[model samples]
Target: MREVAIIGAGMTKFGRSDLSLIEIMSEAAIRALEDAALGDQKVDSVYVANMGAARLNRQTAIASALVDQLNLFPAMAEAVENGPASGASAFKNGFQAIASGMADVVLVTGGERMREVNNLEATDFVASMSHPQAEYIYGVTLPALAGMFTRLYMDRYGVTAKHLALVAIKNHANALKNPYAHIHQAITIEGILTAPEAVVNNPYIADPLRLYDCCPVSDGAAALVLTTREIAEKLGKPIVKVGGIGQATDTHAVHERPDPTELTAVKIAAQKAFQMAGIGPQDIDVAELHDAFTILEIAESEEAGFFPKGEGHNALEQGVTSLGGKLPINPSGGLKAKGHPVGATGVAQLVELTWQLRGAAGDRQVEGAKNAFACNFGGFGNNVVTTVLMREE
Candidate 1:
């Protein structure tokens, strides 16, 4: 396969935006073009990774629609939706195009505008990601399922509620320095712990999980301009190479899993990515983990081999995952602090890692960042995609 490099990465500020889906995605695409120092005329293909423009905005075929809106209508355009991993799926496609010599430069983008719906409507919309018969029909929202799993994790791993709050505190602190992050409020353990006492404080969502523990519904988009290593050299831009990629799937219904604590897909995908990159977890200088919930960040750190099993909480408690810690995770504020707009999440992971590897992340930058890793799990670990990227200078 030909070497693939990310010539540019660009994303919209992930928050409640008044912009429509097309507008948000196009804005990102335009920025990506500028970052790559290329004009719209240079793009060869377009791959979009949005899940719910139809349900959220009554618009569909957003991939082709984006092409026309960006005046790249003649280029090949395709949409990929692997639930929340949709953005990573799009990136995989763009990588294949470059590796196969099918395209020299491709615009890989994903976005979602979800604030238009009320909270209840938004919850119901997100539920559509799982199996209709076994999952969604039971009125299982993502947080409800995650809360159940969190209960299991706590029981099995001896994790405490305080441990989970550490994840939130760390990400929120990191987001404070990220201007593009959705929620930039720096939180304290005392604030989260005491806020849930009164009705105005941290309200309980599902059992064992409160509002602060959950990610906010957001409207956001992120894009990357991908090209071959040769093309990158020709453009004379910083080259962030795609060193490795791995994707795997698991049973969609959470109840059907043999071991709920073991996200088999995540372990397998991360293993493959590490093997392909010829590196271990220790080689990951910086990481952007999928933190859809506070517990997820903890679980994923262990699953990805960044920390030992049953000790993920310990890593966070020791400030090991903080911005200046031994290993920095989610310096972009992650999905928890940055917001989870479903389909846009995975792309945002890569966007953050690209900036980190390029040393462009100002305040939240990991010191001496060289190799970066990202793990994007879709549908509560049912579908997992792990990517390992490197600075190819």
Candidate 2:
């Protein structure tokens, strides 16, 4: 079709916000709109992504509320819900709107006010995305699923708890440099894993996956202003093009998968995205995988072709995924420390990549980075949205 470019990206600090969901999203929208400086141009439409405002916040019609609150009268407004991948799903919709010649400019915003509910309620709400009869009826939460996956992956690949701890330590250190990151507390290996009080400190939520291994329950919002290349030229900023978008799905039940350790959807989605971008995993300078759990970063890296099968943790051990490594992964602190507001996370990945390409990521910047990739995993790999973005100087 046509080329689409992100002109601006903005996100609120990902933490417990007392702001209403609409207010949070609108704030981010206004910031992104200002960043784009779309002087006389009108916003053709708005797509809001969220997962639990209806159930947790007792609200609905979030997109309508956002557009109205921002005073974007008469613009088309629609809400998208695709579990945790909701952000990328909504972003894909915006890309289609611009690329198909339907809209000149689209505002894509994803948000969640998850802190409105207690931790137990939040976990249950996210668990609702699982298969109703097969998973939810049996009370399967995401952490328990991830824990099981981690154990199986370890058995197959020889990954250990120490490697998992290394992931947490690295991401937490990265988060200290990110002002927008939710968890600013620096965690040491001794404190979390090696200390005598480690059990009390990093207690296991599920076997082999402790509290520190999990992303926190957070509330936040992120937004992007996307337009065609022609519009981007007038915006007078460096252009970060949406090179390719790919999405895929797998079996709904974790037990039904042919190989429990393999993330087939991640592999398929990454392949489609790379083919569309006309690049392979080797071409990516930086990446942000859906590290809601530390093991996911390692698993997704392998499935996304960044490493040989069952060798992702080896790369981690070699420092290949660190900030100054050959290919930096999750330089934005990832969902591990940056926080996973479910709906907000996918868009936040794009926001971080846009900043990295623009040379504005500050302390977490990947020097000379040009091509970046993001994978937003949803519902234990049942659904995934992968994106490849390129900077055109």
Candidate 3:
């Protein structure tokens, strides 16, 4: 297979958006195309990733609408949905399109306008990803699952609410440097957990998970332009090769997993990506873990091989995952502060890493970053897609 590299990346601010889903996606795509300096060149294919436009916005065939909106009529258009992993799944498809010699230039864009519906309805729409008989039938929301997972993790790993708060504080601070992050407000342990008004300020959403522990429901889009290495070199852009991509799935229901606290899919998928990239977790300079909840940051860090199984919280307390640390995680604030726009999240993670690799991430940039990693968790860790990206010298 031919090598595939990302030539351009762009994203919309992660928050409530007035623009329609197609329009949001088009905006990100146009920015990416312009970044690639396509100069009127036609794209060979366009892949759109989204989770709930049909359910929330009452729209379908979004890929075709985006093609028309962008005037890319003849381009092969398709929509991909893989729960919350939709963005990365679409990206994998686009990568295969180029690597398999079927297409030269591919546009992969992901967007979700989840705020169009009420908060409760939006939550239910996302909850549809759960198992039909085991999870969704009983109304097992994502937060409830996360809360239980957090409680179990705390028991096994000695992670406390303070450690979770550290994740929130660190990511929130990083988001302040990210112009596109959803929550710009800076938080502190005192404000969220320790202060007298903490109870009212950050009330419990689930038993152990509080309001601040969960990612906000957001509307946003992100896009990337991928091409052959030869084309990337000719474009005179920074070559950020798709070094490796790996995906894995666990049981349909989280309860079916052998160990509920262990993210087996994340571990297996990350190992595949690292092996394919000819590297290991130690070689990753920066990472973007799907931190939909604060506990996930700790759990995924361990599962992705960045920390020991039960010591991820220790790494957190030691400042190892901070921005200036040896391995800064989530320089773009992750799903915690960046907002979780389900469909857009996976693509957004890559967009952030592309910028990190290119040294273009303004304030949140990780200095001298050469290799980056990202994990896009789906369906409570039942499905995951892991990626490795390297900057070519």
Candidate 4:
């Protein structure tokens, strides 16, 4: 196997977009090619990750359209969808293409225009990710399941709504410095505490879960160019190596799991990645955990071994997960503030980590970041993709 390196990365601001999905993707793909200083001719293939075009945009076979639009007529193009982890899965394919010597360079992009649909329609669309018989048929939206798991977390570990609110405030503050973040407005600890009762009250989206705690529907795209390490150094771009990658899946039906808190797949995937990277949680200088919901950041952090069992909330309260703290998590404002355009989120996490590892994250940069980890969870912890990235020496 060969070492894979990220030669370039680019993304459009994650928010409501008037442009069609292909248009948004072209913007990102072109930016990536420019950033890599590589012409379209250098791209050997393209892998797209998008979960909603068929239902939301009335589109399919998007890969062929993308290749033609970009005039990459001779290059192979395909799409990958694994619920929300589609982006990371696409990246994994690109990485393997380079590592296996099958392709010298590949372009991986994930884009979604979720906000185009109304709230009710959007809710039904997202619910498709759940099990047809057990979850979707019973009308269990993502937030409703998250609320149930959150209630379990709160009851067993004493995690409070205030703790979850703190996660929201922290991420929003981080978003303030991120020009590309979806929700850049800052909210105070007090603001979140009183959010449930305010004039434009953060309505109860689900029991114990307010609107503020959930990631907004968004439209966005992210792209990355992958090649062998030697090629990257020759190009004189900042070096970020793909040290390790691991993925795992659990029962999609939430009820089938004996323990909702475990997220067995997360632990297994993290362990595989850490082992492959030859590092531990302590070796990671910065991190980007999946924060589709505030509680998810906490749950993923704990499951990823950043904190002890039932201690992730305490770690947050003590500032262990803050930007300047022990391990800076989600300096990109996370899905909480940066927005969660489902399919785009997994690759977007890598974009942030790449920026941080290269010391290029201007205002939100973590000091002395050398190694970073990202976890992209899918379908309420039913599936996950973990990547360990390091600054190439």
Please say which candidate is ahead in TM-score: 1 or 3: 3
TM-score of each: 0.97, 0.99, 0.99, 0.97
Candidate 2, residues 1-393, lDDT tens digits: the string is: 989999989999999999999988988888899898999999998999999999999999999999989999888989999999999999999999999999999999999999999999999998998889998998899998999999998998999998999899889888888999999988988999999999999999989999999999999999999999998998787899999999999999989999989899999999999999999999999999999999999999999999999899999989999999999899888899999999999999999999999999999999999999999998999999999999999
User: In model 1, which regions exceed 4 Å deviation?
Assistant: 39-41, 194-199
* lDDT score for candidate 4 against the true structure: 0.88
Candidate 1 local lDDT, 52-165, one digit each (tens)? 888899998998999999998578998898888999989999999999999999999999999999999998988888779998988889999989999999999988988888
List, residue by residue over 1-393, the lDDT tens digit for candidate 3: 999999989999999999999999999998899899976557999999999999999999999999999999799999999989999999999999999999999999999999999999988888888888999989899998999999999998899999999999999999999999999999989999999999999999998999999999999999999999999888788899999999999998999988999899999999999998999999999999999999999999999999989999999999999999989999999999999899999999999999999999999899999999999999999889999999989
| Whole-model lDDT values for every prediction | 0.89, 0.94, 0.94, 0.88
Candidate 1 lDDT trough over 10 residues, lowest sum = 194-203
Runs of candidate 2 with Cα error greater than 4 angstroms are none
Model 3 score (lDDT): 0.94
Task: Return the lDDT, model 4, position 91.
Answer: 93
Q: After superposition, how far is residue 190 of candidate 4 from its true place, in Å?
A: 1.8
Number of colliding residue pairs in each model: 3, 0, 0, 0
Worst 10 residues of 3 by lDDT: 33-42
Tens digit per residue, CA lDDT, model 4, 1-393: 999998888899998999999988888888787778874337888999999999999999988888888887787789998888998999999998999998888999899999889989988888899999888888899999999989999999999988988888889989888888898788875665754544255667887888778988999999998989888888887889998998899998988889888888888889888998999988999989988889999988999999988999999999988889999888999999999888888889998898888888999999989999999998888889999999975
